[model samples]
Target: MKDKTNEISMKKKIKNKAFSLMAKKGLKDISMREIAEACGVTKPVLYYYFKDKEDLCYSLIVEKSVVSNENLKKFAASGASFEEILVFIFSEYMQDISHKDVFPFVIHVSSYLLSNPDLGKRFEVVKEQNFAVISGILEKEYKKGTITKKGKEMALQLIFANLAHLILNSCEHAIKFSPSYPKDMARAILKAIDYREK
Candidate 1:
């Protein structure tokens, strides 16, 4: 039991260190040795926890995605209205981008995934699972005639594109947005999709 606990702790430490390093340096520039040294562990310790750099990177992506999907599921199950849920998700994303580590980490991971087709395909599967949860929520709105099927599809694209824009402009250009940005963006998206309240 103690060994397992220690193992979990060590793995968390290694991941956190690696995430920070990769965010700053990009995946191709970072090495397992550097991650091990950052974590104050030997190279062998990192290898014991992760088979290789790709394994560690993939694990990081999965860990974050799983937590995000779980939260989306919980929020969707909470019976919030579609507008409320959109605001909540946008707000959460805004908060995440505000963190120093998140934006760069997302960029690093995205660039890495683009270059690694196999890994990108695996990521797409995880992404689809998340989309399904959001789609389920959107389906409720569709059934009630608040949104058309085309509107539902556009809503998904608009929401994610908006988030990507926010992160990119905010991080790369150091742009700042008001506290009400999330709610404003949510309303804009709904308006763009011609959503009608039932």
Candidate 2:
């Protein structure tokens, strides 16, 4: 039992340091040795916990990403109206980014993935799992003729990406935007996805 606890603690240390290293230097630029050093562990110990660099990347995506959770799945699968769902999602996202840790962690993982396309394939399963919940909602609307023939990606991109961009832009570039931007973004996504404005 103590061994298991120590293993978990060491893994957290490795993940935390690896995240910082990846955020500082691009993902490919950082090596296992550097991560091991940051954790004050030997190369063999790091290898025992993670198979390789690819395994570490998978760990970061699968184990470290906070985006995948039962709450998010439940929210997406809720019977709320499309507009309500959109507003709720964007508003929650806005609140999430306001936290000191969550937003930056998301940005780090995202930026790393953006640059390293090859590593992204490992994350595809998790992405598909998340998409399934929202896709069901979008498909229901599509079948009801409430939305155009477009699939779920359009709505996902418009809501998540646009809202995230607004927050990130304000934080990094001092780009001026109204505080109501999240609400407006939800509305814009509604329009883009052809959901009738209410």
Candidate 3:
């Protein structure tokens, strides 16, 4: 039991240190040796916890996405209106990206994904899982003829694009919008996609 506890502790330490380094230097720039040194561990010890840089990064992203998807599921099950749920999602995201540590790490990971499409492909499964929750809700509306196929696609794009904009501005500490920004963004997306509130 003690050995297992120590192993878990060490892995957590390694992940935290690696996240800090990667946030500042990015994935390609930092290495396992550097991550090990930052965690005050040897290269072999680091390897024992993670197979490679990509594995470590993927682990981190999966951890975050799991929690994210859970929240999405909960919101979807909350019996709220679709528009209300969309606004809530945006509001939650704004709160998330406002965190200094989280914002930089997100930016770093996003940059790495954009620059390496092949590597990015590995994350598509997780991305699709996250999107599936939203798409499921949208499909209900589509089936009811409440929204068109194009409208569903446009809604997803608008929400994600606005989220990217929020993250970028938050990273630069240039967020000048009012506290109602989330509601405003949600309204704009619904308007753009011609979504009818049911």
Q: Output the number of the lDDT-best candidate.
A: 1
Misplaced by over 4 Å in model 1 are: none
Candidate 2: residue pairs that collide: none
Displacement of residue 1 (Cα, Å) in model 3 is 4.0
TM-score of 3: 0.87
Instruction: List per-prediction Cα lDDT, in the order shown.
Output: 0.85, 0.70, 0.84
Model 3 alpha-carbon miss at residue 88, Å? 2.1
Candidate 2 per-residue lDDT over residues 102-129, each given as its tens digit: 4455566677778778777767777776
TM-score of 1: 0.92
The residue ranges of model 3 lying beyond 4 angstroms of the native Cα positions read: none
After TM-score superposition, the amount by which residue 109's alpha carbon in candidate 2 deviates from its true location, in angstroms, is: 6.6
Worst 10 residues of 1 by lDDT: 169-178
Where's the lowest-lDDT run of ten residues in candidate 3?
169-178
Question: Best candidate per TM-score, number?
Answer: 1
- Cα lDDT over the full model 3: 0.84
Writing each residue's lDDT as its tens digit, candidate 1 over 1-198 gives 999999999999988988889899988789999999999999998999998887898788789778877887788788877788898888877777777888888888899988988878977877787788778888888998999999999998988897778888767548887888888988998998899998
